[model samples]
Target: MKVKVAKTAGFCFGVQRAVDKVYELIDSSEDPIYTLGPIIHNEEVVKDLENRGVHVTDEDSLEKLPPGSTVVIRSHGVGKAVYDKLDGLKLSYVDVTCPFVLKIHRIVERESAKGAHIVIIGDREHPEVVGIRGWCRGDCTVIKTSAEAEQFNPPAEKQVCVVSQTTFNYNKFKDLVEILGKKRYDNNVLNIFNVLNTICNATEERQKEAKSIAGEVDTMLVVGGRHSSNTQKLFEICKKECENTYYIQTPVDLDSEMFQCSSYVGITAGASTPKKIIEEVQEHVRIKF
Candidate 1:
């Protein structure tokens, strides 16, 4: 079997920034370190950090930390109220939020304060979405799909701005915007629709590459954390193109049987995935061949 790998399949800018910050802080400080949440979505990475004494304790475990302990905010970012809580505790910390996510929060805050209803196109429960919503003074709606967009009844009839989580699926964002536009015309709603392409360029480029590879290959191997939204989306995209797609977090998840009848294999990964994981998976498939 011939094995192909995407050059873009690994950590993107934001994940790299977040992961690097954790190491920088750990190396520089003697004080006990804590992350507000898992530094990144990958379990292997988080476990490695934990082994290094860089730990993520629950919010209720806050008091157990030393008084002067420094906290690192994860890349996905957190709400404004969470910052206030951190301040109330007089915690010293680093804000390692991805610049891309910060940009979305700014957009959400600015547009919502102007009395325009805000529509966030992404998973409602995602930490990034919840963080963006916290910035808005007026109410905002979160919808994951065109179906949600169709059924959604806004609190206000007119004046709205639309934004997306940085890692959200780009095509879905565009499709939802088009659906919202149609809804506006159907209701004769005087809309102030502003659609921002908040999806990161890295995500768009990697996904595009994955789709291209999936189309020509007999089977695809998607490597990344199971909880990674972008990784799961990659699996969905590849599965549609190549039905013999396998979603694996690491080489351990791979089966020799999946490769038995395959002539060509493609490999892709989520933005938060480390390059070593991808390389190992690629090497595994080659050995089987």
Candidate 2:
């Protein structure tokens, strides 16, 4: 059996930078360190950081922190309220929010200030989306599916600014945008609507790469945290291309039985996955199957 791993499979630029900064702080910083959330969606990385004395915290828990504690904002990025709260607490912080995500925040903040309704195309409850929502100075909407898009009924004259969560599925983002365009409101609304493709380049490349590899393989393995949005999107894309797709977080989750009928296996990982985990999965497939 030939097992092919995606070249784009592993930590994207933002995730790599955030994780690296945390480890650097662990080695150099004397103050107690905490992340506003898990630095990334990967459980293993978060657990490792916790074991090394880097505690995971939430915005509500900021007040409970001991004095002189330093907080690291995770790549998911928080809303403006979080920064304000941090300042109110007078706690020092290191912001490692992904640049792509930060760009969306700025766009939402700017557009909403100008009286445009902000429309975010992604999961409403996702930290990233929640953060993006916090940036809007005016009305904001989060639409995750075609049904949501169909039901979206903003005032006919509302000037809209549409942006996507950086890790959202590229094709789905397009579909949602298309649905929004077809909504039964004023025809002029499309003219005033500004749709920005905010899905990061890394995410687009990874999803496209997974689709291509999955089409050519007899079986596909998608590796990442179960709760990882990008990883889940990859799994969804791969499953559509190849029915024999499996989502696994680690080598232990792999079952040899799933590969019995496969001659060519394609492996791809989400943006937050670590290289070490991908390498171990690759090694396991090569040795066990």
Candidate 3:
């Protein structure tokens, strides 16, 4: 069997930096450490941190933290309210929000303050999208599909500014944006519509690479945490190209029977996935098949 792995597979820079920050805090500080969310979406990493005395805390749990506690912000980035709350509570925090996500917050904050209605292309319930919404001072909408874009009706007089979730699928972002562009023209609101390609370059490259690899393989494996948006997106892209694609968080999730007759397999993982997990999956495939 021929096995191929995406060059872009595994932790991107932002996730790796966030994970490193947690380990740094664990090694150097005796104070109780907490992450606003799982440092990244990977459960294994979070469990490893828990074993080392670090803890995960959410907004509800923030009030319970004693004064002077240290918190690490995850890469998804939080809204302005989170920072305000953290400050109000007098907690020290190391912000590890991905720079790309931080850029979206700044853009939305500025544009919304200037009377632009914000339209985010992403899952509404995602933490990153929720955080971005916190920055908008005016009306905000989340659209995940071309259908949503078609159904949306922005006030003709109000300017509209569009941005995307940092980890959103690139092709999908473009499609949604294209649909919105047409809607803007049809409504004669072209002059007031602005589109910003806020999807992270890492995400774009990873999806592009995964798609390319999937086309050449008989079966594809997407590895990452189940709750990871980017990983799910990768699986979506792979599945479309290779119908035999499977999404797995670990090697144990793999069924050897699925690939017994396959001559080529491709592997890709999300940004939050660790290199160790990717290697393990690759090694297992090599030894088992």
lDDT of 2 by residue, 1-289 (tens): 7999999999999999999999999999899999998899999999988899999888889999999999999899989999999999999999999999999999999999989989999999999999999899988989998899888886667688899999899999999888877663545444467899999999999999999999999999999998899999999999999999999999999897889888999999999999999999999999999
Extract clashing residue pairs from model 2: none
Which residue ranges in model 3 land beyond 4 Å of their true spot?
186-191
Model 2 poorest 10 in a row by lDDT: 183-192
Misplaced by over 4 Å in model 2 are 184-191
lDDT of 1 by residue, 89-177 (tens): 88887888999999988888888888878889988887888889989888889989878998877554657788888878777888888
> Please, what is the whole-model Cα lDDT of each candidate in the order they appear?
0.86, 0.92, 0.92
Q: What's each prediction's TM-score?
A: 0.96, 0.97, 0.97
TM-score of 3: 0.97
**Model 1: C-alpha RMSD to truth?**
1.4
Q: Which candidate model has the greater lDDT, 1 or 3?
A: 3
